[model samples]
Structures are given as structure tokens and as C-alpha cells.
Target: MAAAVTASMQPKSMTRAKKWDEVVENAYRFQLAGYRDEEEYRSVKKVDSAEKWDNGFVKKLQRKDGCFYYYNKARECSDKDVPKTKLYNY
Candidate 1:
């Protein structure tokens, strides 16, 4: 019981990062096509509570219109419309 509790309490250090990377990578690959079920993974990104930093957070792609880039400013996803390109060029 104690071991189980201890294990559960351990930080999920890489889990989130791994998931984030996967989402980004898939989005980068599929872009707007990911949304229409033309691609495998669903088009998804962090749209809310995005933060701005020294380097600035990159905006996500995969718009609802099948065209245009994500509208993001000051680390916040301001685009009322969905984006259709990768946050960064890979």
C-alpha cells in the first residue's frame, strides 16, 4: 500500500512532455488535413491558458477552415478560427 502510494505520488516528469511532443509532431505532419479525418490523429493543440515568454510560445496549426495559420499573440491563442499550419516549420 505504501509503495503504491509512493509510486503514484512520483512526478510524471516526461509523460506530459512526451504527449505534448507527440501532439505537436502529429499536428506538424498533418496540419489542417488532420482535422478532416484525412489524417490519423485528431487535430488538437493547446489553445487556452497559453503563456508568453522571452522566446514566445509557438502557435499551433490545423485550423478549422483547412487554410490559414493559427492566430496567437502574447502566448495566447487569440484566433477565433482554427489554424491550418504547424506552429513552427519542421
Candidate 2:
């Protein structure tokens, strides 16, 4: 099941993203929702996957409080935010 896969994907070490890219963008999205990444998000939210756009960017996310957050079609993660985004290694 999805839960088993997510559990196996847990990170062993983490580091801040040095540049802006798809991976950093995803990390930014997850961190904004108070999660480490997609795996953590799925585990906490109990969802199969985060809703994404046609361009493959995160489209919507629900926080722990049950509030939903929507993202724009454009890139949400900027150069200034790159240093704040964490990249996880399994």
C-alpha cells in the first residue's frame, strides 16, 4: 500500500537546497505545509499523493488543521527561498 511505500521512503539525512529546481520547489511546498516532503505529507495527511498541476507542480495541500492551501500555476519557489528548502536523502 501507499503507507508502506511512504514509510520506506523516510529520510536518513537532510540538507538545505542550494539552488532552485523541481526538487527544491517540492520541498518548499511541503515545508510550507509543515511537512518535510511528499512522503511525510502523505504519512501525515493519509493521502496517496498531493494534487498537482498539468505542469507537475503542487496544486493543493491540506494542513493538519483541515485548512486547504492552493498554489498558482507559476513557480512558487524563488531563489531567495532556495536556502530555506530542505532536501531529504533516503
Candidate 3:
């Protein structure tokens, strides 16, 4: 009998840091500041990963609400005070 392939055997694509940055930027139009809360950063990171896996890398940060935002490259926030905002509105 032939061996069956499992879901885990499927090949997965790895996302690059640059692509992730683009996705995050598109979702939120602001400088990341590179100083986000651990939870918040992880949430955004998941979004980026999903986006990369599904739609490939793009220069935009897409929110769950389907909103797109842009980010600045030169400007950034300091670790002491990274901007914080609600993920979504109820």
C-alpha cells in the first residue's frame, strides 16, 4: 500500500522581515516605533503572517476591519514611548 500524505507534510512558505514590515505599514499608516507592547506586536505579527501566506507580501497594513494604512520609514518612535492604540472598536 502507498503511504498517504499528511497535512503537516505540505510545504509552507516562509515570510521575510521586509514583507512583514510592508504588511504592518499598510495596516497602520504610522511609524511602528519598533516599541510595541508584547501582545500588540504579536497580534500584528499574526496578521502579517496570514497576509503573507495568503496574499503574498504587499506594501500595506490591512486591519481586520479591511482598512489599509501606510507607514513612514525614516520616522520612528523611541523604545521609552511607543505609541499605543486599540486594535479594534466595539
Say which candidate scores most in lDDT: 2
Model 3 Cα lDDT, one tens digit per residue, 1-90: 012323443334422122223334332332232312223333544533322223333234544354664433432323222223212211
Cα error, residue 56 of model 1, in Å, equals 4.0
Cα lDDT for residue 25, candidate 2: 89
Best-first order by lDDT:
2, 1, 3
Name the better of 1 and 2 by lDDT. 2
Question: TM-score rank, highest first?
Answer: 2, 3, 1
Models 1 onward score TM values of 0.19, 0.86, 0.26
lDDT of 1 by residue, 1-90 (tens): 123223333334322112234344333334333441212222133244222223444344444444544434342322332243233221
Q: Which ranges in model 3 have alpha carbons more than 4 Å from their true place?
A: 1-59, 78-80, 83-90
In model 3, the Cα lDDT at residue 24 comes to 44
Candidate 3 overall lDDT versus native: 0.32
What C-alpha lDDT, on a 0 to 100 scale, does residue 6 get in candidate 3? 34
Residue pairs with backbone overlap in model 3: 26-60, 26-61, 26-69, 27-61, 27-62, 29-70
**Better by lDDT, candidate 3 or 1:** 1
Provide the overall lDDT of each model, using Cα atoms, as 2-decimal numbers.
0.33, 0.84, 0.32
